[model samples]
Target chain A: MPPVLQIIDLKDSQATRSYLTKQTLRSWLLTTDHKRVGLLYLYTIIVFFAVAASAAAVMRLNLLTPRGDLVQAETYNKLFTMHGVLMVWFFLIPSIPSVLGNFLLPLMLGARDLAFPKLNLLSWYIFVFGGGIALYALLIGGVDTGWTFYTPYSSTYSNSHVALMAAGVFVAGFSSILTGLNFIVTTHKLRAPGLTWFRLRLFVWSLYATSVILVLATPVLAMTLTLMALERIWKVGVFDPALGGDPLLFQHLFWFYSHPAVYIMILPGMGVVSELIAAFSRKRVFGYTFVAFSSLAIALLGFLVWGHHMFVSSQSVFAGVIFSFLSFLVAIPSAIKVFNWTATLYRGSISLDTPMLYAIGFIGLFTIGGMTGLFLATLAVDVHVHDTYFVIAHFHYIMVGGMVMAFMGGLHFWWPKISGRMYPELLGKMTAIVTFLGFNLTFFPQFILGYLGMPRRYHAYPEQFQVYNVLSTAGASILGLGYVLPLCYLIWSCCYGKPAGNNPWGAKGFEWETTSPPPSENFEKPPVQTEEAYAYPVPSSEPITE
Target chain B: MNARAILYEQFSDLEQQRESSLAGIWAFIASEIMFFGGLFLAFTVYRLNYTQAFNEASQHLNLVLATLNTAVLLTSALTMALAAASNKMGWKYSTLLLLMVTTLLGALFLAIKGIEYIEDWHKGLFPGSAFAWTGSDPGHVQLFFVLYFLMTGFHALHLMIGMGLILVMLLLTWKGWINSRHFMPLDVTSIYWHFVDLVWIFLFPLLYLLGAKI
Candidate 1:
């Protein structure tokens, strides 16, 4: 038996106690437990997701007709802006990191909690406070500057609550900073005795890389937004071209942070898919060192490519060429990751599990998303497609198709460990299939619409584009159902699902060695790793049953 | 000292706890560098674009008060270092005395900064649309003042946070919550104080000294 099996005999009452039960409301409100904190983030982001999705639903409903039909132009503007702000800052950025990273970083490292658990709780409070202010801004009179808050319009013209919205995002940026700080310190100092750096799991590696970006990039966003808020409040000429300030300067500063902020949104999803691919393939990740290094490469190269977002914003031609080339260079690492994941499944025993389905879907969709990104990187092509549905469709493919799929896959993969219950596998697989189909249906048409010269962010469009918009609306409804189904079933499984024993999928990692729904301090005694990560046995022709 | 060391459940022992605390603060300082780094980047970009305007704007600053404030902040950093050293030696009374001096010096710097701000307001050098300055490239000069006030304002906020942290450390030290062996709190706070000072070190040259000779 493994050293982990030896600790199975050391289990006591504490080992069986679930983190969810037997905790007072006040205890949960003030808890410093990382697991509880992760749950807190989980519950909170889901609510934000619902609000943003409803805004999306309203937009899709209004877009059904070529003429303005559903709501006024102003309301439509606010809808998209509200969707972008809430989705980007409140949902997608924090989705995986605060939820899965918070819950699993300590467990995977064989540590009891993050390096500073109290700071972890404080990070959550900060997120809520920031989110609260943003939500209040939305409720009173929404800002229509879009999420980018591009200057001139945001600073001088827009009459909405720009300051409140900026303040909300500014304060929320620190929560991300604090969480990243916690993970960096935890990963550096809290590993088990025998767990060497190379022995670390891919998920942990990805989280570490994500943390680096979060630490470095978020503060830039904070500062940029601060400048934006100040400019709006004081009518400063910092970004106002009328007052000798260059608007391109605003674009430079904004994309300097916002572009890397995209990676911040997706890198954790890449990490989650890494874990899912390995577990389902019953093999170690092929080219582990190359795959691990690719993450850092993406993070570092991610910083250089922010200039690409400014290609059409009056940026100089030579600068555009340099940024375009750097953008292509960043794509190399993402391709490296995709190819490595495919090689890991070669001749290996691949299980068509729910998580594996989502992982495979992520590979296909992200490739399409990433390839379209290359087209956008080309200066000539981007000038044609900039500010069109093409840009919208391209990012949605990456953010929604790529990141959201991986998030679902990971949540399902780890749900048993998290909730100590089995969420009917057939239902899980169905959810994955529906989401993949619905996602493609929703975004694939937007590409065609964009190519045919349909501009984005407008309340209405020409009559010829009505069919594609109708198709998109149809796909969005299906996608909304796809999302709602999982949310319902996952919550149901928390209470009514069958009990999940330790190592339900027989996955190889320090996390699975502990009991499902791990105790308050993560482990009864700290686990010491005795073998390499993903040390599954070689495949036999006869399928092995659980 | 060994028996008195307070170890959290996450760490295996007090030594590991101390190492983690130090690493955590260093990571935080790295992020802080990036936070201030953004403003510096903006300053460099605008300075390169509008060189004469930035220099003329720099001439308007109260260099005497800024220079004095810089010295005061540097002296506080010295006292902060001495306090950490005293805490390491378990010299509680000396640590308290050094901390008090550091806090007083920090307050003095803020006082000097307040006087400078009042002087600027009287001169109508603030970034609003008010009419007072008769200088070349008034628009770009306003840009310079915007950056000057924003950078210094944030620095003052960080100093206030440092003061709060020092007060907490002082309370903890007096209540026997921290000792020589368990002085990681003091160590981390001093590192943070030094970082605040280091940002001003960069700020002093960039804001006050950069366009002085020009």
Candidate 2:
């Protein structure tokens, strides 16, 4: 006998469930089922979305007039800080990956469930427990550390709820780590027979890349936040410059996780877009190898360029120059991905459905987002424009405009399968159009505001910045409308939308090869892959299940 | 059916699963290395900046106690490995004993850690605005203590978790549930226990040896 015992002897969760389901509270609370766990994450993230969106609303109200008419500088500071904290930490990062990824990864991989399902649900509890403490912090008061939680300020200066929020973030880090662990183990051990690595749907590859980042990067963030909490509660001399600690060290620690974190946000959407582009365009993904490896390249190259955020933090000049260079290098694979995606659409049977519209919107916005990133990557320009609205515009272009678009596209695309119901395609397209228009209207003006030298995180602005701020605030209203529309229809669709046929889009992935609204167990028998992912020239007339 | 073929059929799946899991665990451990690796690099850089102070500070670290803890931790790791091995060999009694010993050693390690924290408290090495120390470089001496607390405290947390896991393993072993065939529990616990040991193996020398030139 070999010396090592197998580490994963997960009990059939149904046994645990049947026992728990006998007790109602235990059924819901003690449930270790991945699907139930996903629902918990979905519910919690929705709460986070509401909380963060409210902050955004307040921010827009304050910006209604250029100068601060509603909230004080301190209050304004808290709003923006909370907005960023809730969105990045609570919603955007975990939205698709944690909830949907947890739900789908095992199913798509043809497994019994994730390698560690209890860990999956435990991750959700950690997230919500963390969110509770953070919400309590907001209720009592708030932290002024900014979402970045920049040190010394977070440790010494801010009083609202730094410890509580940092503790929340610290706790949430475990969730990310567990999710990543579950995904990594699942992808490694759980594939159906004949489902090789290259045969993986691009979405699977995206989640795989995302899971890697989650495992590798999140622990650093956890430690950073732990150190911050210690400093706040105990007055530790770790980041406090009064005691000879370097504030710059904290920046290094925080950004190391947060930057790669942005990839965690986008990689899944990139996965979604890949499926979207392929299905709608009726093509095998052009340059499939390049596109897949490009995802991996982006995840890897992502770690090298975190220093770009610190150029103006007075890091060594040589370091700044090097970061600028490496930042440019990171863009190459991202550019290659975009090119490959656009190439996939060249002269195919293109369908401009709701999901496809969002995908196209993603291409345009992400291109702008990405190109502006290049502008920021140059030392000379970045030094001039660091912490300006240009930076704001640059990220919003990618984050809200690109990732959120792709997320919505994926949601619309998969809603049929997930709910066994199809949404009104017309309404989804209208929402897509309004979102794009509002998004551009909101952020496009901010680029000029940045160029004209308006700083971010300020409650009031000078007369010159007024016009842009007003336009931006107006755009937020429309953007808010766009967001609410989907919540309405998606919920409606769950109950009343028409029953979707299997292979509704005639897409060829293992996921769609299964039934719409797949059984409690994912498959009757493992799916056999006789062809490549997104295989073309398989007549559109043929069913995806064939 | 003969026991050998039954075992053979079971062994192949277990072996493949083990190889894949070990690869995954090693990958995870490498990331952990990079995680703590960043902190160690920071400690190195800061120590380089204040070698004399760091040297003086190292004298205050209880080397004998640290040495004792290291031995205890490494032994726990050995027990953890034995538990995994014996599980695979169908040595049920041996698996439970190894698990119990591993858990016991983990408790001893934490007890030593508590004593060390008490000693540091007596020495005024705890970090705070009011903290005071008599090392050559006050600034970096405090810096040294910051690292000391962070690294050791983080290590203690890991030990606590390893202890919890061993307890869980002991429970499963008690139920006569764990065995050679379905031993994922042993493997996972071993990975975690070894990780905690590996962290200390690095920490002991960093905190107690290098930079001690005073």
Candidate 3:
């Protein structure tokens, strides 16, 4: 046999003693293991992603013609509401953090498990219970309040399952809180002996930033949802303008949690892209401290810019300008990240691996997303595009194009470690390309249509806009294909793919020090980090700017 | 040696375990602050908009009972602090006694709050359709009452959770699961108890005292 197959056989023999060795269902369901919890989250979120994507498919089909003949207008409202709610709370928000963060944090720290392993298990249970409640609301006539659940309509007017959906989201917010709390405590307390602050991976830093937002911001959302639900039930509660309460107060409170929520969704993806870029390029990340601090900057600055979303809601012009300016400030840290990633790739032994494809795609797409965000942040421009598809396209570029691409990249990058198997690389690269092409084809034209006076959430449009609608729906089909291909191949790889030895990609993180599908205890003995992160052996002329 | 038995498997030593638990609870409390902070913010906005009506509604609250309840909560905090201190000093029976006193004080505060709710109901101060307020601005007064009930009700909910946790600590102490050497549970619980008390400290002034200056 060749040397590679011999090594594969050696690694394959160890799989019997790994975390996957347990075949009993009870072990998985009641596991306090962070890796198992992460896998549980991975399975749960994938199901939610499929459900939300199906909702998007129906909506896209409905929008294929100038006149929406596929679903009724009310159904379309419900469709988008379900899509937005699931995609935001169920899928995107928890995608990277709960799954990858839960799996990797302990491994990277070389700890036995998360600080509170039982709490980690509880977070997953809360997530699933909350997901069940949200689905139940959908079954009993879905809510149409948009995921925003903007007031007056959600509180008084809309006659759908508003309170039930709010309750679902309210319960789910605790999961995010617990996960954030667990991560913060673990990062503070559980690092291996020599793993000081700067020596940690950028992913850990970004997650720490993300957790700070998650811990502080999610509770406000929980309370806001509770108040909204109470208002819907009481009819005389807060946010009812007729009752001398202000609807704008609801908007302020909701966005206070939500704008930070956007960071929660994408920051982990940025962390993931950071790791992928460094690992695949085989170089130290350029300006490590700057990149680490930029994550913190984005989290801190994310809070002050919530009011930008309120600029057109009769908010004071002075406040709008401040919010608009603060909104512009967020782009600086984001640009720092993009520039540093690009700089890391320069003069490095760059490999066009599957993960690198997604990372590069993220840099290009996130730049587009970040730049368009400034247009919306401008006070004068927002007046025209507020609540339009321009707003829709901008966020999708961030959430879908940016976050989702980074998620796929991280998943592929970490797949061998996660599943102890290698997915077919050609198919992985093809999915990345198709997803990038499909995402832009779907959303890019919507920006044009929005600028040309097409509003969002409308089932029917003017005949002049039908061509773009057609193009978007076509892109939706391709995007759906991109998502489905991974589900099939990744699952197939789990059972049939060739056994991948430890450190298949020659990655340098502490996680790569252990076996793929690491033992239930994570490491046989605790690891002490000695080298700085992404310290590629090839000497770079770049000075280590601490 | 007994404390060693209580250490979780994930931590390297007892000190790291205690440190993590403290950090974890503090993080939890920070989130709780934002939770209550949202309601406080809404109250601030509406109070500014309808100052007179909110003041009028605030005046109707039974200040005497609420003041009494405030004293009850403060005493509970003192006892809670003593309990934590006693646990650290390894005085098993005294710690249990102080914990019981703290839990009772919490119950007394809740009972007084229940009486105040009944009094408010008799005065038709509730926010629903039956709210019998003919004040300067009935709508705004109703809004004021809506916020008052929500804030105080949520605060009461948190106190109940704290009380339940205290009961668990009491049992653990009785079972000798929490001793001086392994007092992190009691320590963490006291922090939570004090946080609840502090929230009430803010609420008493915001809801009950805002109208006192007038």
Which predicted model would earn the best DockQ?
A: 3
Cα RMSDs of all predictions?
A: 2.9, 6.6, 2.8
Docking class of 1: high
Worst 10 residues of 2 chain A by lDDT: A1-10
Look at candidate 1 and tell me the lDDT of residue A118.
99
How many Å off is the CA of A9 in candidate 2? 40
Evaluate model 2: give its TM-score.
Answer: 0.92
* TM-scores for the candidates: 0.97, 0.92, 0.98
lDDT string, candidate 1, A227-253, tens digits? 878888888878888877777777888
Q: What is the per-residue lDDT of model 2 for residues B99-180, given as tens digits with 9 covering 90 to 100?
A: 8888889899999989988988888877676567864668778788888988888888878888888888888776766666
Interface RMSDs of the predictions, in order, are: 0.9, 3.5, 0.7
Q: Using lDDT as the measure, what is the rank order of every candidate, best first?
A: 3, 1, 2
* lDDT score for residue B84 of model 3: 95
Candidate 2 lDDT tens digits, A79-134:
88888988998898888888777767866676656766666778888888888887
Error of 2 at B89 (Å): 2.2
Residue B14 of model 3 has an lDDT of: 90
Winning candidate number (lDDT): 3
Candidate 2 off by > 4 Å: A1-33, A538-546, B1-24
